[model samples]
Target chain A: MGIAREHDLHKRRFSRNRGVGLALAAFVAIIFGLTVVKVSNMDVVGSYAAGSLTAGGDK
Target chain B: MSDTSARTTPPPAIGGEGDFADYFALLKPRVMSLVVFTALVGLLVAPVPAHPMIALAAILFIAIGGGAAGALNMWWDADIDAMMQRTKARPIPAGRVAPGEALAIGVALSGMSVVMLGLAANWVAAGLLAFTIFFYAVVYTMWLKRRTPQNIVIGGAAGAFPPMIGWAVATGGVSPESLLMFLIVFVWTPPHFWALALFVRSDYEHAGVPMLTVTHGRRATRAHILAYTLLLAPVTIGAGLTSVGGPVYLMVAVALNLWLIWGALNIRRRSEETATADGYRAEKAFFRFSIFYLFLHFGALLAEAALRPYGLGGW
Candidate 1:
């Protein structure tokens, strides 16, 4: 009985740890996905022109 | 389960082998990317044409300065970072780098970047770069972060300085256009950050950081997000009317503002239980969208600059 109880506690602890790890991984994956989407959609060339004009107008 | 027993922990060291990649990571690449892009815009839009070589050097140094600030932030925040799930794996917290080593790297890079910028560009740009590093590392990281719920509100200023530094690089002075860009970023930081703060309140609480959610409660944070979003719309649109902005930027600004306002309004109306019922998914989506909104607005500014030669644009 003692051995079985110890084994069950270990199983529960292991499962709890796995759950936390999985949640953390999912969070990181979401942040990475968001970053990739933002970078891909960035209008880099257009921004350059707008920036230049702003500088030009100040003169 | 078997893998856990088989795993062997690596020895503790601040940065092993002194590899270029490790050094680069210390700079906070995401933040540096924004600094580079804004500075590039500042250079391109400036009436004064910098020789390509000088412009490249200026941008490179500005990026290095940005990295130095990140390294110092990591060093100081290492203790809290270890507690937060999101930051627990960072270099210092993970035991891959030492706090003191990170501090040294930050200080050395900070000086190098500033001095090189002064030589390759102008003293004004160098001065701005120096101030940015100081503001982020000293003022924001050291003084404000742990002490105030308004940390991000004030600390946000450090992040807002890049475009101004870039502008100074080209023109050796500040201008209304750069200030407008600065204002847009400044106002946007609160709502952008507070959205994440709401969802991650537990982490801040665990780390003992006084984020708005921790001090003011979730309802107050939601209210603040709405108020800031409302304030952000005009600043964003006004940038489109500046010499740097044009019809293309204006159209984008209007649409993005409306979408952001919708998200903020939705967030304000939802209860914590309701938000949890949706897996906090709506808040997550808003957080994701906020990142894109800033990138798009700045990207639109670049677009306006491109169309200027045809006499097709004015802000």
Candidate 2:
């Protein structure tokens, strides 16, 4: 009975740690994804601004 | 039984004394890349032209300011980072660099970037750089992040300021065009960030951070992502209609926004089990596409600038 109880406790602890590991992986992925999106969008914003400004100047 | 034991055991520690790469990591290279690219766009799109040397100086200063913000953010978030697995390997948390050292580097770079920009460009650009550093370090990292679910919503403003700073470097003041650029980024940030938040709620929960997922639940977070993307679509299209963007940008915005909206809508429609079964694969795919979306958009602006002399580009 004592050995069985010890094994159960170890299993619970293992599961808890696994949860943490998965959570960490998700967080890293999110940050990376966010960074890439922002960096990539820079040109769209810039060109749009330039086109409008030039058009306004001509008018 | 063998698999169970392997799963139950902790991975071996990869921690050790750091090297140059660790210091570079402390600067947050990915964030710096965004800052550099946006600032370059701001410089290029501005109505006033700058000498090449001055333009180079402005970009370098903006980059240094971005690095300063990263160092300080790492210093302040060291505790939470140590707790969170994703950040556990970071320079300060991983024991590669001391917190005090990071603090000093942050402070030194902040002053250097601001002063150099003021000299090479103008005081306005310098002032904006100083504000960007303070906003990221104090407002975003220290206060907003832990305090609210809207953390990224507001903290994202700091990231959006770089292009405006670049515009100021060229034009010596803020203009309507620069403000529009800032607005587009500001609106885009929430949807961009919340997509990731949907899948990473557990990490924020473990760190005791009140991200949208932790505060509002995954369903509400998904709804918010859709709402923000809807808002982002018009702003992106409007920006393409502006002076900085031309026909090329308009076409790109239309296509990317359509795809982005599709991704957001799919996330909204999917069941939690279905989303989770693939680890929110649709949302993850959207997040991946989001990165390319922004890169292509910005790269198009550079292309527009190159074509301007040939009468092939104009607002």
Q: lDDT tens digits, residues B152-237, model 1?
A: 99999888898888888888999998898888888989888889987887899999999999999999999999999999999989
Which ranges in model 1 have alpha carbons more than 4 Å from their true place?
Answer: A1-59, B1-20
Clash totals in order = 17, 25
**Winning model by lDDT:** 1
Mark the regions of model 2 whose C-alpha exceeds 4 Å error after superposition: A1-59, B1-17
- What TM-score goes with each of the models? 0.79, 0.79
In the order shown, the candidates' DockQ scores are 0.02, 0.02
Query: How big is the positional error of residue B219 in model 2, measured in Å on the Cα after superposition?
Result: 0.4
lDDT of model 2 at residue B98? 76
| Model 1: lDDT of residue A19 | 58
